[model samples]
Target: MVFPTGSLVNLIAIVLGSCAGMLLGNRLPERVRYIVFCGLGLATLVIGMQMALKTQNPLILVFSILLGGITGELLQIERGLNSLGERLKKRLKSNNLRFVDGFVSATLLFVIGSMAILGPFDEALRGDRTLLYTKSILDCFASVPLAASFGSGVLFSAVPVFLYQGALTLFAGVLQPMLTPAMMNEIIATGGLMILGIALGLLDVKRIPLSNLLPSLVYAGVLSYFFM
Candidate 1:
């Protein structure tokens, strides 16, 4: 069996960081946690802007977003994700801005973007897990502050992170061939826009139903195929 060391390390980092954050949270004042959220929001905006700017053609992205949004709405993807988050929150008996809050936010933050996709693809193809390793470190630090405010549910994010990237990594040979360079960039752009939405939501400027746009990632590729 090909050991997925990169993914395993990423999981370990999230768990450790979350646990450490939880411990630190117990001692830190609530104000400190709020500050962390604000900082993360600013950082996310910067990152999102960078990714959004990477697209060579703006029209393709606009169409992709519009179509993807419609598909997501028709499918009720956001509602399903919200329902799942709420149910898990109830089962865990978590209170305030924790549990479901952390899970959804952290999962989206960790799951989308180019690194989450391309990193695994490269790892499987070239045995170079550098991008994933770098991402793991960033996630470790990010998770700490998130767990401080969002609660232990942040730890559960590792589940989606591992599974999503692992699947991509394991099947890189098949998927990579299907995604042309242009398609990949468009997909990354869409993910960046979603990440930007997540940032805006975090900043309390708007409440974006980001999960509703999950189909946007795939739509980006499709749209790119035609535009390319």
Candidate 2:
């Protein structure tokens, strides 16, 4: 298969899944939606904890987040993402919390995992799209409840999912030297931190501008290259 073709399939899966979820959601009671969202949140926290545990050095993760967060805030990355999400929201005439949460949470879920990293690289190096295709299938199913609980904003998340994984697939050769296993672990660990915040937001515990932390993934990789 062509490189990133799997990502295309993945995108299709998420879109179809979201459509199905939206249909199903309209029939569910508000209380049931709330319960499902909470369960997803708790599950997210558990997943984040598991990824975070991959880090060999917590200090590296900490530094990557602090520094990368500062950079992201300065660049207003969250504002940029919000603007994009808002464009879609305005088109739908929705200013709902679930919409925003769905977009943010779906993007995080689809983009943060090891599958995202390995899928693209494997495709580039081995002409193998198995991992990405698998991820797409997984995302397809995962997007259902997320869209059901949140809203159409979950559909918009497919944009980032495509860009992130697609770029990695196309550029894997150039990035190979930089993306060491150690660095990959740190990146996942940093993402786990972001995922934790997403979980809290979903649970109604507290709101987190998790988008602003996106740069930490890059920063963690850089730090890992030099320090690890």
Candidate 3:
């Protein structure tokens, strides 16, 4: 179970970006911070749109969302995550620590896309770092704005990204056999739609319960397994 070097590099960049953002956030004016957020929102939209266009199976995507949303709702991922963040915040007891919003938002922003999952598989099995490297660059830039808006809590998100992608990459050998090209494409497309929702939320166009839809990615994979 060996993880790719790209995952490790991505993790480092995220941590560094968050730290840099936190350090510089205090010096940035409110207007600048607001503009950064807007920039992030637009970037997210562009990425999501591009990813969405890659899919040919709309039915799979729709069904994946339906089943995945149900699973996520049952699992109570949003509530559970908020509870965990609240507990951590309380334990730390730092008035400056607003952990839940930043941590959750940043984690989703970094992890809920096609590249996040696909990158690990690509790197671990194929020794290709193109997607992961690109994702890391995007994450680094995104973190700057996120940290400015959310404060130090954004830095903590690196923990989840590391754990999630590291585990995926480590197990890439086992999963590689089961994952096919079409399956991977469907999963990426599903994640792209989710990322679009997140972008809309960031832009304040609509507030989507993205956490509740997290199971959709799993559903997409399963659906892909059956169909692809």
Quote each prediction's TM-score. Answer: 0.94, 0.92, 0.93
- Whole-model alpha-carbon lDDT for candidate 2: 0.85
Q: Is candidate 1 or candidate 2 better by TM-score?
A: 1
- The residue pairs that clash in candidate 1, if any, are none
Candidate scoring better on TM-score of 1 and 3: 1
- Model 3 lDDT per residue over 1-228, tens place: 555688778888888898899888899999988888888899899988888777778999999989988888899998887787677678877466556788788888899888888889888888888998998888888888888778767777887888888888899899889877888888888888988998887788997778888888878888888876
**Pairwise lDDT winner, candidates 1 and 2:** 1
Off-target runs (Cα >4 Å) in candidate 3 are none
For candidate 3, the 10 contiguous residues with the lowest summed lDDT are 91-100
Cα lDDT of model 1 by residue, 55-121, tens digit: 8888888887888889989999878866777877788787756677788889899988778888888
Give the Cα lDDT of each candidate.
0.86, 0.85, 0.83
Cα misplacement distance, residue 219 of candidate 1 (Å): 0.8
Report the CA-based lDDT of candidate 1 relative to the real structure: 0.86
Cα RMSD of predicted structure 3: 1.7
Clashing pairs in 2: none
